[model samples]
Target chain A: MIRRGGRRGGVVAAGLLTGALLGLGFPAPARADPEADRIGFRSYFQQRFPDVPAEAWIDGMYAIDEGARQQWQEIEDFPPYEFTVEEGQALFQDPFGDGRSYGDCFPDAGRGIRQRYPRFDSETGEVETLEVAINGCRARHGEPALSYDSKEMLALTAWIAYASRGRPMAVEVPDDARALAAYEEGKRFYYTKRGRLDMACVDCHGRYAGAFIRGDHLSASLGHPTHFPVYRLKLGGMVSLHKRFHGCIRDVGAEPFDEQSREFRRLEYFLTYMSNGLEANGPAVRK
Target chain B: MRDVVTSALVLAACLALPVARAADDSRTPAVEGVLAAVESLRAQAVTAGHEWLGTRSLLDEARAAAASGDAARALELAEQARRDCELALEQARREEEAWQGRVLR
Candidate 1:
């Protein structure tokens, strides 16, 4: 199933070399221009699907898959994630044994703030995901931190993402050197080939995006951040971003990184930034 | 005369082929040693928290081959598994630093 032919080895090296050369040639040297990358990324997808509106991409492959789009539309009529969202709302309001609530931990009680997460915390010199921030709040409140890939965490995130629905993704890769380094690290992770399959995220979702792999259509990476904590019918459960990352890595035969690992946090940081300006639509149903 | 030389060459190659095969057959199989090396690397990968699934599958196949008494096949598989695990370990190490080189500008 691993397609090895065409555009594998030298393409990655060429990209790296080109970037390095460009960095050296620039007057004010910077490792990357997120703005330029954003323009290019959006343009590529736009050119690929001239008819599909930018906002429609939040639906992922359904933007391209007509049949799946119909099914997804039907499924969304009575969304499967409603129960989980209700549970998340209940959990959010429920106070810890210490008598404080999840609201106290976040700005605006975490309302409409999903866009700002996976932020570079200058204090910690690491990317802070929503899951990490949630657990941090729990620990501070003398409550147990939930597992990054647990149903509780997913439910909580689904609620938060629901709260932020229609809010644009606004993740920042801060100007700090540490933050920049983390962003670059995430960019590297995205492009690097691994596993016996020797595939990078770019190979499928980047280059051959919209191309079919067996029965599944590869979704472009641009709008990946829009819909998350998705209710996957195949999985018959909610899937967190970290869980999806694990599955994708394992799909290519690579060892899955630990959930909420530094590498994963960085990846989330980069990916969410890529989807900046896209409206958050979560607790989404997916096939 | 040309035919005679051609015939002689063929006869010589035929004689040498079995000798080479016999030499290969005479050497001690390296399967056990290679399998051990692969297992060691697998343990290291586990400690590093980056064990590759392919490494385990290849090692399992090598073990099965060994159990079936196909030393040559076992040796080949074991050597492959060893190389795979070694590469996996190296990948984990190299990415620690090499990731920086690929940052998009």
Candidate 2:
């Protein structure tokens, strides 16, 4: 269910002109249908890169770039994230002071559940990301919440992601008004220009996906959330999806929201939903 | 008469120097006011979730400049920061509707 009217043509023309004048980039007039949005979003990328298979989007930039794909295939031979995944597995199984572990709070002992994250918790009436859930679990059990950037949190997410590899992304935008509003807000955040650079997420990932920006290929937004807790060669460490969001926001000259912040959680919710059928292949390597 | 004229000019110049310095010192309060304006706008931007990077830093730098008695520099930085905040607020408002256009169909 979409909340806004689908006015077309003139709105698009005016939007383009305004965007050009503002240097913020153009957008289609608003549509509120979540399923339609997902389809349109996916179709845009699919049409743009016909040769790439739908499932390959999990590879991100590598899915479209042949040379980079070859290099990435080689990197996969000896994935740098191996140790982190092991560490995460240990952390996952380690019990809290009450002798109950992180796995106790999640379904299936927290195995193979990464794809269902950034869920809309109706009770809280807010987007509850896996990170938030993890922290909440800690709070409920009388344990201190781990910082989003803490090694233990990163490791735990990495292991969970590893466990969920190959499962398709399954984020849902419930029919409730608050849920829809949250989704809409996330969509707006993706397109809206913020920061000193005056660039929106759409400007780079939508308008210029597959284009080289300073020798780095911009990945399509379609499968952005399929992979997370990526080990970046540049950072020589693992970073969760929200951490990546924070960095991208900062890169655009905006003051970033905190990790697992409501803004970021909403963003993750919208972004992950866009990749509804893409397989989760996290704890992946990136340049 | 020429010597008298030269001495008179020198004395006048000496007296006027302090007056000029006093006038310049008076600008400190004006710069502080600009800094305050920048801070207010920055808070608004932050509230709107549109605060730009470097705005806070610019405000800090302006305060530092004011503390160091560089009224001109302080004014310049404060004005720049204020402009940044204003632009951010404008962006936030513009995006309210413009974001719809950017959505994928």
Candidate 3:
């Protein structure tokens, strides 16, 4: 269950989105004020759920502990993190389907504007959104493929999300029957109960979106993904979508999906599509 | 889908109901756990008290969860019951040794 705090506080935020999109109407968050940076968002969340582990809420968007390396703390390295960022930058720089980079496609790879995902693609005849397009770029360009659920891909994806920071998520399914079908399919996935607890993703996040779960406040999933690649407290660094999905399942004692399993991808498609109008703030942190 | 949230919670409660029953029956899982932990400590006898305390807290939390209307939440809390007791047993052993050594000194 992703919460909606810490600039779309992962599951906490995800929960809110889940509830709202499912037609479970809870109050959407008030519009973010000008000072609505990750820190402010996090502070507001902490006030609401003080019991959540303090470490769980630390923002991971900034460069990891350069000072630690400056000293001698023997910090764990994230060369892969840098590599993933490079990959994302490349995609942003050159998603050239017709010899045109994304810079040429939609200026700035559509930076600071995450409000355009889950859109219907008339040409593709599918609801290909941000991730789908990125993967398509990989396929058409003969780039090494990245799984939708892979951390390698997600880190890059998070950077794309980062590029779109401050932009509202503006996903809109076409009113066509097929698009409606996809939205309904996503809705079905969200409401279905799975896992050992017989819990669905909605159990904690939806029902208790603003309530306490152990030491943490349950975040609504409404605006999830606003800040991702968020530093997971227990994980000790930024994590990807699939990792968060696995975490939710584990907490419910459910069987987690294979790294790129269809069930997981379908769920991702559904969830991300639903969060159509929130911003993307990646490489953040949460409890 | 207002039902999505509550319905899911209801289902979770159902999944966890049996565990609450298990938690209540001391002769069942909880006691068995405490016995296993105490038995382990009797040999080392080093951290018995701590283990006992840990188990106590775990059991308390488990009992609290089991007592909740949401059975799934209870069972989820229950699973930790055994471990918490085990930790307390360890802590007890450490405390006992400290006390004894001080008296001797």
Candidate 4:
């Protein structure tokens, strides 16, 4: 009887050991530490490209690819976005039907303020994007909201981005539960795999940054938000950040969230926060 | 006379089998059932916020096939859509916890 009991005890111990070994394949629950995450995120890229300075990330693929940089410099010389910027300036100066201009709705007359976007609204318990704020301004002045992808909207954002050319990204996640939740949700969205391709944002931008996909080199996620509302030669027009997000999602075989939707807004909030110190360099040209 | 009748009946039965099989080829009810299942799965995937880009287009194609009386084609498209939704939902479930591991820290 003693020998039989010993054998049973040995079997139970072996089962427990096997279970523990299998558990190693799964991830442990991570503690929420935004600062630590930011440090690790920056460190990964810094280590990957030891030659590139941290600030140079704002130039995106141009910072890494020498050939692309030369071509981009040539394009910048004759900046195609000049016309759009002028149109945006005209729209900004023109008064609404209510005799109030777009400047009447924003602080600093809406100049040099692109970096303060994707802000947390304490009252609404949600993230508010620059586009959403622009629409809010329109509504207040009894004007119709522009479509998120409209030429007018792109022009306005391009001008705002141009105005704040050298300002650093200053997105802040307030010390509130809702704000933290939004940030966490956005982070999850960034890492979560979706679509037929089963790829996440991190797979391309994080894991394979500076790598060539066909003719296009993938840019690091570190300073992705800094240069947006970009004029793309392929598109022959200006494209907003959210529009790029839509394209990325679709490229991965995932249905994208609507432009300026809650999901995209939260994503923008989280992404902008990741580039907190990068200078805003938008209304730029791209391939 | 009885033998002759039996032979004729066997020939008729064999001929009728093809006709019955032809009717089964356009099984509209089967296509409808598959489409229904695909829709339910698609809804779950959409709710989970992991719907694939091709799922909706496949579902639309299935509906068009069904309207055009191509039951076999409709069922094929619906099944493809159903598989897409199932994979998306599985992805959603796996990523729910797994995403934390991919975080930079």
Question: Which residue window of length 10 is worst by lDDT in model 2 chain A?
Answer: A1-10
Give candidate 4 regions above 4 Å deviation: A1-31, B1-29
> How many angstroms is residue B63 displaced in model 3 relative to the true structure, after the best TM-score fit?
38
Give one digit per residue, the lDDT tens place, for model 4 in B56-103: 989999888777666778888888898888899999999989987887
Q: Write the per-residue lDDT of candidate 3 for residues A164-273, one digit (tens) a residue.
A: 76665556656566665655444444555543354556556544555656654566544564555555556555676657777777666444554334445455556665
lDDT of 4 by residue, A53-140 (tens): 8789888899899998999999999999999988988888889998998899776766878998889999889999888888888999
At residue A101, what lDDT does model 2 achieve? 84
Per-model clash counts, in order, read 2, 4, 60, 0
> Each candidate's DockQ score against the native complex?
0.19, 0.61, 0.01, 0.60
- Better structure of 2 and 4 per DockQ: 2
Question: What's the lDDT of the predicted structure labeled candidate 3?
Answer: 0.51
Order the numbered candidates by DockQ, best leading: 2, 4, 1, 3
Relative to the real complex, the DockQ score for model 2 comes to 0.61
Taken over the whole model, the C-alpha lDDT of each candidate is 0.81, 0.87, 0.51, 0.87
Off by over 4 Å in 2: A1-31, B1-29
Score chain B of each candidate by TM-score: 0.60, 0.73, 0.31, 0.72
Q: What is the lDDT of residue A181 in candidate 1?
A: 88
